[model samples]
Target chain A: GESVGLHLPTLSVQEGDNSIINCAYSNSASDYFIWYKQESGKGPQFIIDIRSNMDKRQGQRVTVLLNKTVKHLSLQIAATQPGDSAVYFCAENRNFNKFYFGSGTKLNVKP
Target chain B: GAGVSQTPSNKVTEKGKYVELRCDPISGHTALYWYRQSLGQGPEFLIYFQGTGAADDSGLPNDRFFAVRPEGSVSTLKIQRTERGDSAVYLCASSPLAGTDTQYFGPGTRLTVL
Candidate 1:
């Protein structure tokens, strides 16, 4: 079956250190992608997004990199904070309707 | 004035029982979507609505699940004969327009079938 997956299931980083979470998607037909963060008991919150035409997009403290050639997507957080510790997911949209999700990477920021 | 809102923060039902979850989207948002998230996994798309009509329902697992949006605003997802496997968090999201619009998500309803 077609799917998206994360390279690391869990990652721990020191506060103020940078963090990078990687995802690999098998669907080349997907054109739109979004990143979301979810707390333990909450719904996924919108973080950032990138289109297939572009390779990168940045938000307040997060950056999304899309590698079309390798079918890879990554989310980078600058100066990781305790608030940034959450499960990060990469979702790809087809025809802008259905969104296929990666398993997700759990981020843990240690002080 | 608010983000998405879902009713019944938590639900506990026995196996083979029925459950209904509701979602209230943001004002002026025409696109609505439903997704299911299991423990340690990201959300999986279950369905999407464009206005009062369901535009894509292919993500639904089986005929046991159904949803409706008669007025294109509030939506309800109903599951019949829920099993233990149905235990998960049901998430609702809404977008202003179609095609890749930024989605605002609700806190979600946690359904537990035992």
Candidate 2:
């Protein structure tokens, strides 16, 4: 069964600290991955994305790292803030058509 | 500059009833998608549409689920004989193109099957 899963279901981080969320995907054919943040009552917002050709991609205060060898992916948020407290998800895109999402990791930021 | 929008933010219906969920994509977006999210779980892909035609519907769970994207801008997800398990948030997303693009999502429609 092809699936994407997270290593941790919940992560609690103090405000101003860095936070890392991990995910493992089973499909080798997946070439693209994205991280999304969802707040209560709102839709999932795109944080960042990385292609298979790149090992690391960085954005403002955020970074996505892909490890094709181990079939793993990670999203790192620098200087986590209270507003960053939300459920984080990692999605894998296959054949450039469909995306498979993992059960999210709830990030609780303590102010 | 409006993002994707879904109508009837919430719906409560009895089992075996039919329901329709609507989605309005961002202007100029050609790709549309439907997803279902269970409590504490991530969104599950249901279908994808390119322009006015369905490009891929293999993710749909069963014959009870169907979707249409007419005129290439709006889409409706239809569910027939809904079951209790159908209770979930229905999410709609659209991208400028079919693949490798950022998908803008709408505040999902929450369906409760009683």
Q: Which candidate is the best by TM-score?
A: 2
| TM-score of chain B taken alone, every candidate | 0.98, 0.99
Candidate 1: segments with Cα more than 4 A from true spot: none
- Tens-place lDDT digits, model 2, residues A1-111: 989999999999999999999999999989999999999999999999999999999999999999999999999999999999999999999968789999999999999
Cα RMSDs of all predictions? 0.9, 0.8
Per-candidate iRMS values, in order, are 0.9, 0.7
Q: Each prediction's DockQ?
A: 0.84, 0.87
How far off is residue A61 in model 2, in Å? 0.7
Q: How far in Å is the alpha carbon of B92 misplaced in model 2?
A: 0.3
